[model samples]
Target: MKTWIVLLASTLVLPAHASNHITDSEKKTPLQVETIAQFNGIPWGLVLLDNQTAIVAIKNGAAYRVNLATRMTTRLTGLPNVDNRGQGGLLDVAIPPIANTQNWLYFTYAKPTSEGSTTALGRAKLDNNHLSDWQDVLVTNAVVSGTKHYGSRITFDNKGHVFFSIGDRGERDLAQDLSNHAGSIIRLRLDGSVPSDNPFVSDANSRNEIWSYGHRNPQGIYYDAKTDTLWSNEHGPRGGDEINLIRAGGNYGWPIVSYGKEYWGPSIGDGAEKEGIDNPEVVFTPSIAPGSLLRYKSSNASDWNGDFISPALALRHLNRVSINQDGEYTETRYLEDLNERLRSIAQDDTGVLYIGTDSGKLLKVTLNGS
Candidate 1:
């Protein structure tokens, strides 16, 4: 979940001009930002079917099939019922790798249940501009009540496995429990069946769907086909936001080895590192509140290939992280002048980036001369 801080109403006021070119003295190309559309609700997640058509999910229980060319938003029907409580609602939307062939749309949401709300995964056929033939694939084993930490993000790997994350739901201890789905990344087939090769498939006490465990609240996840890597960004306590390289059956120390301090200023866990617990590839001490993760892949932007791009909510900027072959990285911040809480980002086929903000606006970022 995003920080409890509410955005100032003034942040919604658009600039006199919606487009501007921002250049860094050290870079060759300037980043051109354009306001494409503004929303009345929080745009939680988005995916572009083509360069001009997008399916956007709102945190307030709604989804929209937006026409980027015309600045039109059509509220999509046939979505599942969401809790609509704190940090829960229509979350991430993703297309399978075989989208063009299968026409299937997969999404994650906080599903309302008698016991409480649970992170749920479902899919439907996207045809004629509406969702049809809805199928509920998976849900968390334990449904606890909370407004924070649903940890819902979806990604498809090249090996035909679907991975989705679920937060600890404020139950920090649950992260270490493999029998429960909370605080873990789960892998399954496109149809929602557990993959036999999943890490815990043969374990009697563990959930077979679990791929990795000990996540707090991971809002951003991406699969890097080049490295065959699964990467995730999760929120820590007051600090300690982390970007991790995920491995099957891996144990990430949550409540045990966090670098973050507690909300009231106490150290979390037994310092930052511990034996047998996986360490993060990157840790943000000040907390960027990362929202979405995308692996940049383009023939044109050779320099940026394999880098990770994402919006930082608390930091109010877009981050371009260069991950080198040696597994080290450097971070660059972009669009700081926008000063809005960015929630989601997607890149079009042309390599242009689209970003959604908590200020209820949609923005486009392109290379200066593109």
Candidate 2:
């Protein structure tokens, strides 16, 4: 294994402006990025089990327990059979924030079916080297013919609800449909029951578990308990990637009102704005292809506290968006020189960041002069 340390310079300060064409800038903070370990498959999701140990979900239907202190990895057993098709496999893994459910680990993966596959949320307990009492919390009704656009990422609101995202499943119209679970954010109780207060629970035409709909392919989601915000970043067709402030029952206008062009070069939907649809907080025109998101909360002041960080898969950079009190934000890109397709990110107790790349490498990032 090889290790490289790269020093990141300070971000330039820029005024917050409109969501599209937002510039990148930040306060001066030196950063050091180091390669810590290498894995056999793409580390799709990373969650810290404790201060020194983490569980990583591989994209090819495997999981591993990685010790950050000694750089040793143990292959975890007892995971469900995952369909390792295109963009389908073992995806995001998360641990509940509440104290009582800390023993349970949550997961989202592509569960195979007769038609095709669907994103399923499941949970289990880690028993030494194996998982015990594994249970599928919810098998989403999103099976389709293709294998792309699974849109599986997990987050919790710390208020007895767990939220996960599912893509449009390669069907554009499914985003606007309420009958199925595709192209929506779902909220459920920790035990797999639908939350009564969910946005669409009362409507017989909609799925009871849906929180919001009209999403293309949200790969990154984070809930901020302090501000009561649910944030998501999703991909667009040719461009127009978006970071949205998700709201209950809000329609985000995927194919209906997109700023992106179709793959072959025609505009999408009724221009970029519609009356009732919610607009994105930030939009990326050329598509960074965000894989995972993190709301950085740290005791240290220099660690970009309270900012949104995402790993860019297509652009191969660490993307940061700094938000102010008014909900306006700016963007900053880091580590573009490394040229790695960053896949997942998790932060430790000491404000250090651990990043997983599509190249099967784990990286550690720290504030250099802090």
| Candidate with best TM-score | 2
Candidate 2, 217-284: lDDT as tens digits: 99999999999999999998888888899999999998899877898999899988899999887777
Q: What is the lDDT of residue 97 in candidate 2?
A: 89
TM-score of each: 0.90, 0.94
Clashing pairs in 1: none
Task: Pick out the ten consecutive residues of candidate 2 with the lowest summed lDDT.
Answer: 8-17
For residue 131, what is the lDDT in candidate 2? Answer: 87
Candidate 1: list runs displaced more than 4 Å. 1-29, 99-101
By lDDT, the best candidate is 2
In terms of lDDT, model 2 sits at: 0.87
